[model samples]
Target: MPERIRVLHVEDNPDHALLIRRSLEREDDSLEITSAASAEEALGLLEENGFHVILSDYALGSGMSGLDFLRAVRDRGHDIPFVILTGQGNEEVASEALRMGANDYIIKRSGLLQFKRVALTIRNQRETFRARREKEEVEARYRHLVENVNAGIALARGDRFVYVNPKLCEILGYSAEELTSRPFLDFVAPASRETVAERYRKRQAGEELPSTYDVWALHKDGREICLELTASVIRDSEGISTLAVLREVTRERETERRAQRMEETLDLVFRQAGEAIFIHDLEGRIIEANPAASRLTGYTREELCSMRVQDLHVPEEREFSENKLASARLDGLFGFVGTGRCKDGTIKRCAVTTSLVRMGERTLVLSLVKEVPERMTSHEEEWVAAAVDARLKAALEKAPMVAVQAYDRQGRVTYWNRASEELYGFAREEAMGKTLYQLILEAAEAEGFLQELRRVWESCTPAPGREWLTRDREGNRRWVYSTIVPVVQGEECV
Candidate 1:
């Protein structure tokens, strides 16, 4: 079947005109044929018609013959395809029809299928001409794009160059013909040949491979150039091939290498540092302990890695350690004095500075610790205050006749001597954290004592060491002398 074609048929005999339509209709009913009995009548119809092809008889019985009609149509610029049919075979007459621009010439057959053959040939010629024009248009677009694209482009097969755009030739210092004459790897630097070869071979062998890779190519002048190559597989009528897009990355690669070296140097310095350094994960488990850390803790690297930060201090000193960590968590960095327990049960006082550090996906605490001699406390006044308080406590413990005690701003018992334990009938351990008024005073007296405690802490006034009626464990009323003082931190009691 072919495109629906409209035909103008000029035949004197109605039977011959019917025969022509039948021949084309033998394959499909796509031909619309209009008949005219004379050359003059066909000319009139042609002037008012749209037709794809024309068929005319050799002798129309009119003054004009089929060859005359064909020549007249071409001269008038109609240019429609014309075919002629004759009842007799004459070499001279067929030549005349062809010379007059008749697209075809056929001898009339009463019992033959020659008209179908003519119809098939005409359709084939029209299709071939159309296909040629479309191919030329596509090639024009491809040539324009490949010549003006910014990046270098190359087409290859079997890892051998098949074609290269002008930009690729410029990048490699070669002409398009020169680049396509050799293997693509011929321009690759010697050190990068194996990598480039392996990737291309795998791709050509139909194996899965990365779509992009970095390769170093040797320039014609012997200098190395880094190229980031993005590639794709092109499948067309020409068969399978690789298409590569190349970008220069020499400066970017140099910057990356320089930054990598700097990181390596910093890692080495951190490992060989003189102070005890540690990296602990967010869960408080030791992840990395430097050489100084092992020596400082009297533990091997393996031993330290199995412990949490809480495991390194005595229970009494853990609050101070926890406090330092809490401060570091809030501020991102902090410094504090704390005591650390060694593997042999010896204690080492250390000044600890901790900060948050992020490495890859994990967030960690990085600590730089230096040992502080036990006898070299930093603040003289603080040490003296502590010593004087300890002496007063010991003196009160030995004075059996009197019950002496100390309270924090909240009236919690911090210093409870032995005499307090005996008088209140509460063990030293039980009395340590309880409020003094809650332990031994009646409700009314306890309320009054709390009011006076608040006033003393507020005024920085001592409680005049007054005597009060307080109860003992036996529920018997007993008289005791008490005093209150505030432990101050900056402008507030702590």
Candidate 2:
């Protein structure tokens, strides 16, 4: 804007050069451009003065091409913006020019808009290069820090080790030469191979995973050394790589094995756990049903396997079950205290918990069911209900600006208060036990809320409140804040 940009243009064609100069001049009067008929002339002119930008035709009349001119400029330590003007726009040729450090490119026939675009792109590229240089400096410092750290550090690509630090080589009882050429998975014990693979797959898929896991590495003496490995993935434009830090955990592994033995010895204590355990896919198709589940449902394992969760619930409860299943698709698990109709047509009070199990790219749900005792006193039942109601009410009360509601472990309307009724424009009777997720127009948002709740429940901790907007009866979206807390009844936490 002050003195105009100074641009040096090298073109063998007089007509094309004149057209480009006219276009640039028309675009901004602030442009002061000079033209050279050959790369030789451009080089001679550049020795006397600095130019803000350089535009060169890819195919010059002279033997030297634009790429050669670019290399020459770079060899001389010049960092001016360089744009390539080509008659033919081939992807391979364009890529080559770019790789050779061209700032931007445009086909001669592309019109004035492309030239303007190239100019803007050149300005942005300069800024980006500066930022990238700074990032590289920081990364170099970080690499230095990691190199000198005492912990064993090894870098790997997929299962193959690429680099191993001295400390890690010592811990593994192998020289760097022996470790770098081996498949990292070869050192992991067979028992832990699946876990390591799962973690690696997650990292490759761009998931940030915690790096602590148990593994066995082969020592120089060919002995299996149990170790605790902490690892992370380093990702760049190319692909994902692994960085693992190892610690000796032979003693911890021994302790774990002893604890496992003790647990096996005490397995008989839970042989009569009364609770029915059932595992199902996300679609609610029964996959595994324990003896207790078969007895409680009045269905044999063979019969249960063929039945969907919706088939077990009454027609009214079927909708509820489907809604919960859909919610579980988004949230990891869905739990409810509902009455499940047994094969003999009797309804049993049961608590059900369903969790999403991810195997590879597929997800399934595992459900556990426990039958509640019928001999409970009114005081006990009331206490349980009151506790659940109080928590649900408190969640709503705390969310003054937005409505809050909760579905019971059974997918029933367990708590619907004044704010929920007013905000949703639905009466308590209309909303209660109506399948909250399906009833809300913003099903996706409701799904998010449930997912957060499931995470908390699974981790046995308080979950963060999720803010969402739900459609009221009038189809107006009203904001909502929802949180779920598990209510423990007797020895079971629902």
Candidate 3:
């Protein structure tokens, strides 16, 4: 669809006005011409209607002249394109009209042919007005975006800033004039000046480099600030300039550095600490273990990672350890005294402190384990020796067919008779203070045997005797029948 160009024609001569309207309508069907008898009537029509162009005669008989009408329209804040129509041989009058802000002028000639000039002039003036208004609107929007954006923006030519937005001025603690007057390099800190200068030089030389990087900037108060800058070379008719955007990253960089330092310190502590430390998931699977943990558990780092946290405790302590871990999760931190069963089946009384830690999206458990040293005074040792009846000990030592051994709840052997050692092909010294699994059972059978022992301990009943294929210290495999029963000491099962 063609655009409708509304025109207001002001002429005191009724004949000329009618001729002009007919000529314009014949010249272009899209032109809508509205007639006014004088400049006074035109001004009144302008208030009530919008127009794209105005055509008026140079002379308005007995009233205001075309120049006066132009001034009056402008004073009323109507910027409609105004064109003056003058009589033949009045080129000077038209020239004067142009100087007085009349957009253009046409000399009227005889007949309807001269009205074509008026129609052409109106179309040209309307198009020029539309283009100018669009340019002004685009420039206004660009200015608004640059001034109100959060990051500092600058346009630099050579080494100096050509333009700096309000945000840039605020960032450097300088007024617009103060920043643009000096070389941009003067505000860069010494450490980053060379790098920034090199990149700018390369960018100006048309060599492609990283468009965004970090630089240390010098604030007006002389403090160094870290800034992340993104810059691109902008080439135009005025030659080349660089458009740069700057954002402060001082706090974010500091946070990253602090976190890195903390991680390094923690890694050092984990490698050199005296006590064992273990990190595991909710399923009790070990994720990480420190060197001390490997030493404490008598397992290699690789071996520990393959085992669960419960696997490190004796069968009797499994329920207790589980409860402590649950408490740690609920309370954030918890500590307890428990027993740890080593790879060799020797048990240590341990003081364990556990805490729950959240990293990113996952929750983990951290446990610190310290062995509690066990020492018995001479009086205590003597009382323990006297507690065991001598006749029962003698009977166990002499038993030929039955191999008898006694171990604590933690699977640590309390007594190993000579007959038991003989059956397992181990001496009393080697069999004592060690669990039956470590003394005679093969590695593959250790877990299943421990489960049966746990059942007996939990139920306080004798586990059905079963035939077991086991290995000894010499790696000899032998078949034997074994059973486990919890001992009752008063009302409690030990």
The per-model lDDT (C-alpha) reads: 0.74, 0.71, 0.81
Candidate number with greatest TM-score:
3
Choose 1 or 3, whichever is better by lDDT.
Answer: 3
Candidate 2 lDDT by residue in tens digits, 1-494 = 44556789898889978987787777666676799888888999999976777888888875688888988988888878788877664667678888988878777567567668655654555556567778999999977877778788888886788888777877877788878787887777677788888888887788877768777767777778887788787888857888788878775566566456645643432234465766677788887677777888899989998988778776778888888788766655445655688988997766666665543355567666666665666676555444433432443464433455666544456667777777777887788776667577466765666666566556644454344567878788654444454543322345
Query: Could you arrange the candidates by lDDT from highest to lowest?
Result: 3, 1, 2
* Error in Å for residue 146 of model 2: 3.2
Q: TM-scores, in order shown? A: 0.50, 0.36, 0.69
RMSD of each: 25.5, 20.6, 22.0
Q: Which parts of model 2 have CA positions greater than 4 angstroms off?
A: 1-8, 11-38, 41-53, 58-67, 74-81, 87-104, 109-114, 124-135, 155-158, 162-180, 188-216, 221-228, 232-243, 247-494
Provide the global lDDT of candidate 1 against the true structure: 0.74
| Tens-digit lDDT string for candidate 3 (1-494) | 98899999999999978877887899988899999998999999999998999989889998998889998988888888999888888989888888878898887777666767777788889999999999999999999999999999999998799999998888888899989899999999999999999999899899989899999999999889899999999999999999999998876676566457656866776788787989998778999999999899999999999988989988998987787666655554445566789999898876666656655567788777777655656565444334322423453476454577776667667777876777778888877778767778766687777787778778865677566777766788766666675554433556
- The TM-score of candidate 1 is 0.50
Candidate scoring better on TM-score of 1 and 3: 3
Please list the residue runs of candidate 1 whose C-alpha ends up more than 4 Å from where it truly belongs after superposition: 1-22, 30-112, 119-152, 157-160, 165-186, 193-213, 218-223, 229-252, 300-303, 380-494
For candidate 2, the clash count comes to 7
Of 2 and 3, the candidate ahead on lDDT is 3
